[model samples]
Target: KKMIHAGAGVVDYDYRGEVGVVLFNHGTEDFEVAAGDRVAQLVLEQISMAPCVEVEALEDTARGAGGFGSTGVEATPAKRARAEAAAGGAAMGAASAAERTPHVAGEERAAAAGGAEVA
Candidate 1:
């Protein structure tokens, strides 16, 4: 499994030391690392710094106080239909399912093929 320290993946512009990656072995098998191996990738992302103001209280919403997994595990038929519509009604297979998901990148290209890489 891939593991990253908090804020460690993001290297500041002034950081000069050698970047290090940490990996943990949770399986029963032993993993080996050679002299040079492609384990992790560096993805440069533009950071946007915005000013923050603290509010006394947050406004109420329809789903207020509902935390993670509060909406239930299964998606409703209406939700599935919305997802399929968002994917241009291509959510008929595994590849299209990935395309319908919001977090997967290059979804259209993956849908054109057969499936998308899980991780």
Candidate 2:
């Protein structure tokens, strides 16, 4: 399948008849999908039907009642900032680790070569 922009794409095996498109905006800017733009295509194959089961009442949980800023959208800004900071820190750590790896490898090679001078 092709991506309209750089978002996610999904395929549903349970859905039948007409196919549907599911896209998410993972970037900062909003994305649009135009009509007749070939969001997705599906080739019809063998069809099988199954009996559907319906649930009347289901069990509930304490957090089940929470939805849409129920925990306070005010906290979201701080949470996102902290998460971004953590991600940036992790990326930096990975870069530093990569930088040191070559040095460590060079040292090992030098020791292996009868203590020959590196560089």
Candidate 3:
């Protein structure tokens, strides 16, 4: 019989002998494994290999050498500035949600925008 732990354990691919698993219980209470329990699974796959080649220079393109969230990224300073200005010009009084229903969702910002009111 194989002994496989519930937590940190390893079974390397090079092992050719009969295997045993150690059942471990790293829990707050007692753990049990009954008959016909699917305690473990096995997977077989093929590992691909490729030879490395040396090159003199790597070709460059638009947004060259960019990786890790830097690709196609934009700062959009103008849009950010307009949003900040519109948000900054709003009234900051403590009004209840029921009392502000007539103003609608975007009514306050639309009223503050001079001519962008809806409904």
Candidate 4:
């Protein structure tokens, strides 16, 4: 078995021949394990196998149309200033989520608030 650590308490396995145990640290503090230490014990067993076939289909969703950074990034100074003004005028209380909700869920409201045509 090939063992790889993705994170604390998380391990990936590529089992081939013999099985092995992976001991992981779940806590923030570091710990140690010595050789021959009992990380885990295993028993060998025989199993029967059979051939099988599987099929799958692509899925869809409303948000599927958008992808990473679909929204504008690195806003220009003017756009930043306009967004700040709109946010302050609406008293969004320093919460970006509050300002972004309408943009994401209500195009009309977001466009009206930002003095732009809703596309």
Per-residue C-alpha lDDT of model 1 across residues 1-119, encoded as one tens digit per residue:
43322234578977999988776666667777787977677888887788999999999986689998876685643466456668777436555455445453554435433444432
Output the better candidate (1/3) by lDDT: 1
TM-score each candidate: 0.45, 0.23, 0.30, 0.25
lDDT of 4 at 22: 58
User: TM-score of the candidate numbered 3?
Assistant: 0.30
Using TM-score, rank the candidates from best to worst: 1, 3, 4, 2
What digit string (tens of lDDT, one per residue) describes model 3 on residues 1-119?
24345443555667788865566755556667788887766556665577889999989875688877765354233343355457773233223221333334555534433334434
lDDT score of model 4? Answer: 0.49
Task: Tell me how candidate 3 scores on lDDT.
Answer: 0.51
Which candidate achieves the best lDDT against the true structure? 1
Range of the 10 consecutive residues with the lowest summed lDDT in candidate 4? 1-10
Judged by TM-score, which candidate is best?
A: 1
Q: How many residue pairs clash in each candidate at the backbone level? A: 0, 0, 7, 0
Which of the two candidates, 1 or 4, achieves a greater TM-score against the reference?
1
CA RMSD for every model?
12.9, 16.3, 13.6, 11.9
The global C-alpha lDDT for each of the candidates, from Candidate 1 onward, is 0.60, 0.49, 0.51, 0.49
Deviating ranges (above 4 Å) for candidate 3: 1-30, 33-37, 61-63, 72-119
Runs with alpha carbons beyond 4 Å of true place in candidate 1:
1-16, 26-30, 73-78, 82-119
